[model samples]
Target: MQIDVDPQEDPQNAPDVNYVVENPTLDLEQYAASYSGLMRIERLQFIADHCPPLRVEALKMALSFVQRTFNVDVYEEIHRKLSEATRDLQSAPDAIPESGVEPPPLDTAWVEATRKKALLKLEKLDTDLKNYKGNSIKESIRRGHDDLGDHYLDCGDLSNALKCYSRARDYCTSAKHVINMCLNVIKVSVYLQNWSHVLSYVSKAESTPEIAERGERDSQTQAILTKLKCAAGLAELAARKYKQAAKCFLLASFDHCDFPELLSPSNVAVYGGLCALATFDRQELQRNVISSSSFKLFLELEPQVRDIIFKFYESKYASCLKMLDEMKDNLLLDMYLAPHVRTLYTQIRNRALIQYFSPYVSADMRRMATAFNTTVAALEDELTQLILEGLINARIDSHSKILYARDVDQRSTTFEKSLLMGKEFQRRAKAMILRAAVLRNQIHVKVRGGGTGAGAAQLGTHTWAHGLVSIAVPSPGREPGGADAGQQPVPDEHQHVRVPAGPSRRICTPYPQLPALLEEPLGSRPRPPAWTPV
Candidate 1:
C-alpha cells in the first residue's frame, strides 16, 4: 500500500536523500551509545555559556546526571562548571539586571526536597560502591556510616548513634571534626544518663584544654562546678549517705553563692533535702543553731542581704514561731525555769523595773519591757486563779493553812521588813515602765520634735505610781548572821503587831541608801540607801 506522508508532519519518517557524502560519515552506533555523554557535554556547554546566570536547579540536575551515568572525566568537568556557576551567582553584581535569564526561585521547601532526593541517590550509589576496592570509595563508605550514625543519634537512638559516632571519630581525617564528634558523643552519653561515660567524657573534655578554655571563668567554670557538685550530691542522696549528701549540698550552696542564677528549683530541692537529712544529727542541729545565730548577727552588717533573708524566712515565720514556742516550753523551761523559777521571776521583775527608768536604753529594750509586762500580767492572773481555787478546796489541811500563811506573809513582809528589797523590785518594775515611756517619748519626738508635752506628763504619772509602791514596802530583816532563814514564821494580818524594840529600831533607821529607782545600774552592785523609798 502506497501511503502518502507529509514530510513536515513527521520529519523522522522522511527518507534520507543522499545529496553528497561528507569526508567521513559518522557511525550511528558510536553516536547512539555516546548520546548520554554527548547530551551531558552539550548541557554543560549550555550552562558554561550562560555561566553567571545558570539556574541552580538546572545546574544541579545536569551535574547529578553527569555524576551518576558519566565517567570521572565528565563528572569532574561538570563539577568544575557547577562550582564556577555557583561562584558566579554568589559574586554577581547586585546592580546587574537578572531579567534576561531568570534564576529559579529558591524556595527552601523545594531545595530541601531536592536535597533529600540527592541524598537518597548518594546513598544508593554508596551501597553500590561498597564492594569496590578503592581507597576513595572506602573513605566515602566510612563517611556514609558516620553520617548515618549521627542521624540515628539526632533521632534519639543512642546506641546506634554512639556506634556511628565512634566510627566517625575513628575515620575522621581532620582533628577539629574528630574533636567535635567526640564532644557530641559525650553529650549524648550525658543525655542517656550514663554517669560513667559522662565522667569519662568530662575528663576527656577537660584534658583537651580547648573546651576547658572556651568559657568564662565565672560563667563556665562555676557553672560546670555547680553541675558537678549537684550531680555528686544527687548521687550521695541516692546512695542514702545522708552526711555525704549534706556536705555535697553545702558545697553546692557555696558554689551557688558565686553564681546566684544557679540557685534554681533543683538547687533548692537539694538544699532542703540535705537540711532535712542533717537535722537528724544532734551535732548538726547545734551547728545549725550556731550558724543561724551567727548569720542573724551577720545580717546586721549586711542589711540588704538580711532583708532578703528576712523576707524569705518570713514566709515560714508562722511555722518558725510555733517551733519557737515548742522549744521554749520544752528546752528553755527545763534549762532556765525548772530549777530557778522563783529566782527567774524575781530577776525578770527587777530588770523590768530598772529598765523602765533608763531613758538611755534603746527602743528594743522598751519592746522587751512590753513583752516582760505581758508575761508578768499573765503570770499574776494565773497565780490569782490558783490562790482563789486553793481557798475553795474542801480538803484543806494544816499544811494548806501554813501555805496560805506563807503566801500572806510573803506579801506582808514586802511592806514590813524587806522595804529595801521591795523597793528594788519596785524600782526594776518602774524601770520597765519607764523604758516604755522612753520609747513613747522618742516616738513623740520623731513626730513633733519639741511640740508634744503629753508623753512627758504620762511618763511622770507612771514614775510617781512606781515611787509610791516602793515606799509602801518594808525592808527585809537579816537573820541573826544575815544568813537566809529557812521556813521563817509566816506573818498574816494578825501578825502586824508591834515589832520587838531592837528590830523596830533597826527598821526605823532608814535602810542603807537604795539605788535610784529611775537610774539602777546595769551591774549587780547593791545600791546605796540614799535613794531608798521614805
Candidate 2:
C-alpha cells in the first residue's frame, strides 16, 4: 500500500518545491532591470528555485545585487545556492567549460563589515527613537521608527522591519503620518508574502482621510492611489480571486504606476489582461479592458497581452487560445502569476467554448472542434462538463455529435410576462385614477381637533343639495344654531368622506373669505354665515 501525503502549507511562507519549470522564455536581464531592491533579489531567487536552465544565472545576479545592500545573510544564502547550481551544471554530461560559470568567492571581510555597520546603525536608531519618545515629539518618533524599519528591511529582516513599521503607528500625528506608516508596513508585508496583511494595510491607507477625500487633480494623491491599487491586485491574485484582482490592476493609473519595488507597467498589463480574459464576459471585456483609455496605456507596454485580449473579444477563439499558449512559458516565470496560470488558462478556454455556442441554438460538434482547435472527443467531453455544470442549457447527442439547446416554450413565457405586465398596469391605472379624483375634488384633510364653537358643531358635516356635497367646518367662538347642531362630534381618527353616486359636482368646502351657508336636512336653508376678511 502506498500512502500519499499532501504537503503542509505554511500560512507565513509558501514554498512550491515540487513545482518545476523546464522551459522559460524570460529575458532575465531585462526582467531584473525592471525592479530594484529586495524585489529584484527575490524575483531572481524565485526563478532560480523553479527553472533549472536559469538557476545559475539567476543566483549569480541575485548574489551580485545582494552585495549592494546590507543584507549579508541573503548574500551568503544566494552564494551557497550559486555554488550548488554551478556544480550541477559542471556535472552535466553536455556541460561546456566556462570561466564565469563558477560561483564568486565569499566576501567574508565585507560581510563582517556590513554586519557591524548594520548593528551600529540599529543601535543609533534605537537611541534616537528613545530620545524622541523622551522628548515627546511625535513626528520625530515616527521618523525614527521608520528609519529603523528601513534599516531592517535593507538587512533582509522582514519580520523586524514589519514590526518597526507597525510600531510607528503609535507615533503617527496626522493622516499623512498614518498613510506613510501603512505604506511601509504594506511594502514589507508584500515582501514577506503576507497577503492578508498587505490587503489590510492597503485598506487602512486608502481609508485615511487624506487619501479618501483627495481630489483626482492632485498628482501626488493619484500616484499614491495607484500604488495602493497595485498592491491590492497582487494580494487578490495570490488569493485566487481573478475577477477582483483584475479590477484592482485595471484601476491603476498608468502615469502613476511607479511601484518598481513590486511590479512594472508590463506586469500590470499582463496580470490584468489575463485575469480579465478568464473572468470577464464579452461586454465587460470590451467595455473595461478594450475601451478603457487609462488601461490602454498599460496594455501598450505588452502588445502581446493586449492583442490576446482583442482577439478574444473579436470572437477569434483559435487565434486567441494559440496566442495564450505561446505566452504560457513566459507567464509561468512570473512568481505572482505562476501558481494560477493553469487555472486561468482553463477558465479562458471554457469561457471561449461557452461564448462560441452562445448565439447558436444548435452547433455541429465537428465544426466546433475545429474552431476550438481540439479533437471531436475532447470537444464532446468539454461540452459534457459544461452541460452538467449548468453553464450551457443544452443537450448533447453522442451518436450525432450535435449540441442542441434545450427547447423553451417562449409563447407561454411571453404570455405569462404580458399578463403580469397587464396586471401591474391595471393597478397603476387604478391608483392614478384615485389620485386624479382626489386632486380634482381638491381634498384637504388635517388631523387637528375640532375646537369648541359653531365650528366644532359643524365640523365633518356633509350636506347634499342638487347632487353637490359641501363639507362644513365649525367656526371658532360661534354658537351652534344650525339644523345639524345636535349632531355628535366625529371621532378623533380619520373620517371617511363619501362621494355621492350621482353625477359629479364641484366640491365646495368652507373658506375664510367666502360666506358659507348652513342648511337643515328637512329642505330648509339657514342664513349665510358672515364672511371674515383676512
Candidate 3:
C-alpha cells in the first residue's frame, strides 16, 4: 500500500519500517491499512515528547488516527488501547514508553529551512490573490488563505498563521466568514500567547452588535462567540486578571465549548469557578457562579471546581485552600496557566481570607491565622495590604492584638463631624483673640495721640469693670504722663485691651506688679499661663 505521508515530513528518517519485510514486488493488499496510522501515533508522541514545538501537530494527528481507525472496522481492544496510549501521550508526553524502540530525532536546521520556505510560499499565494481582479475569485482566495493559516497553525507556526487569517478577513463577505475569521484570529493569538491581541480582536468582533444579535439567531455564530469568549476568559485567567476572566467565562455559552479536545470541559470549570471565588464576594459567588444558569452546564463537566467553591461557601475555607494546594501540580501544568500558577495560588489565599471574614465585622488575628493555615505575621501582612488598599476597612491594634473594623455607618460620620467642628472652632477663636488685641492697640494709639493733657503717649490701655483707665505716657521728648487726680477714669464699653499701633512700641511688665484681670470678661480675659503665676 502507498503510504500517505505529510509533505513537510522529511525522507530518510521514516519511523518504524521493518526493513526485512520490504519486498517491492509483494502484493500491496496483504499489508495492514491501519499499520501506518498506528506508527504515525508513536512517532508523533515520541517527537512531541522530545520537541515541544511538535506537540500541537502531534495532538491533531492523534485525533485523526482515532477517528479513522476506531469509528470504522478496527478491533475494540486495539481501538481502546490506541485511544488510551494517545491520551497518555498527549497528557504526559515525557512519560510515554519508548517500547525499547527509538524514533528519529528532529533536524532543527531542516525544520528552520522548511518553516521559512512555507512562509515564503504563503506570502506568494497572498500576493497572487490580492493582484487577481475578479470579484468571484475573492471568496475562493479567502478560503485558500484561510486553509493556509490552518496548515501553518497545525505546524505550530502561529505568527504566520495569524497573518494569513488576517488577510482572509479582508475578503470576507458573508457573516459566517466574518465570525470564523474573528475566531481564527483569536485562536492563533491564544497559541502565540498574545493575550492583549486576543482581547482586542474579541472586543472588536463582539462590538459589531450584529454579532450578538446574529449569534443569538445563527447556530454557527453562537458557537463561534461561545468559543471566542472562552478563549478570552482563558487569556484573562493566565494574566491573573481573575475578575475579568470570571465574567467572560460566566457569560460564555457551554454547548459549543464542553469538548474534551478543545479547551477541556474540566479546565472551564476549574478556571471559571476559581476566578469567581477569587474576585467575587460570597453573595456574588452565589448569584453569579453557583446559582447562575451557565454554571449548571460548566459544573456538569467538572464538579471539582464547584465542590471546592461550595466548601468555601460553607465557610470551610481552610479545606478549600488545602484542596487547591494538594492539586497544585495539576493546576500548574495547565497549558494556559503554567506561567501564572503561583499567582493563582495567591488568589486562592486572598479569596479565602475575604470569604472567611465576610460575615464578621472583625476577626482576631490568631483565630484568622489558624483558620487560614498561616502564621500570624503572614496573616498580619495580608490584612495590612488589604486595609491599605481599602479592600477591607479594618485596622490592627498592634499593642492590644485586636483587629477592629472601622465603622462606616452614620454614627462614625457624626463622630468625624464632631472632631472637625472642634478644630474649626479652636482655629477661629484663636484668630479672633489675636484680631481683638491688634484692634485694641490701634484704638489706644489713636486715643493717646489725640490727648493734649497727656504727659506721655499711652501705647496701651486696659478697660476694667470699675472704669476705662487711659494711663498716658510721656512722648519721646516729654515727661511721663499720669492719671488725672480729680477725675476717676470710667470704663468704655466699646474698647477692650489696647496696645500702641506702632511696631516699635512695647508693653512693659514687672511680674509682681502685674495688673489684676478681675475686671476682664471671662471669655475675653487674658490670663497668664498656668506655669506663670499672676
Candidate with best TM-score: 2
RMSD of each: 38.1, 10.7, 19.6
Better of 1 and 3 by lDDT: 3
Per-model TM-score versus the true fold: 0.24, 0.76, 0.55
Worst 10 residues of 2 by lDDT: 514-523
Q: For residues 1-534, write the lDDT of model 2, one tens digit per residue.
A: 998766765543453446777878889999999999999999999899888999999998899899889999899899999999989999999999988887889999999999999999999999999999999988898899899999999998999999999999998989988988988888899988999999999999998888888746789999999999999999999988999999999999999999999999999999999999999998899899999999999999899998999888889999999999898878878889988888899899999999999999999999998998999999999889988999998999999999999988999999999999999998776555544544433332322232445543345544444344433423433334556556665443213333343433333333423222211122232433333422
- Decide which is better by TM-score, 1 or 3: 3
Which pairs of residues clash in candidate 3, taking residues 3 or more apart in a chain or in different chains?
440-498, 441-499, 456-473, 456-474, 457-473, 467-491, 468-490, 468-491
lDDT of 2 at 515: 20
Pick the winner on TM-score between candidates 1 and 2. Answer: 2
Could you tell me the lDDT of residue 506 within candidate 2? Answer: 34
Candidate 3 accuracy as lDDT? 0.60
**77 Cα displacement, candidate 2 (Å):** 1.3
Per candidate, the number of residue pairs that clash is: 27, 2, 8
How big is the positional error of residue 6 in model 3, measured in Å on the Cα after superposition? 41
Off by over 4 Å in 1: 1-150, 164-186, 203-218, 223-534
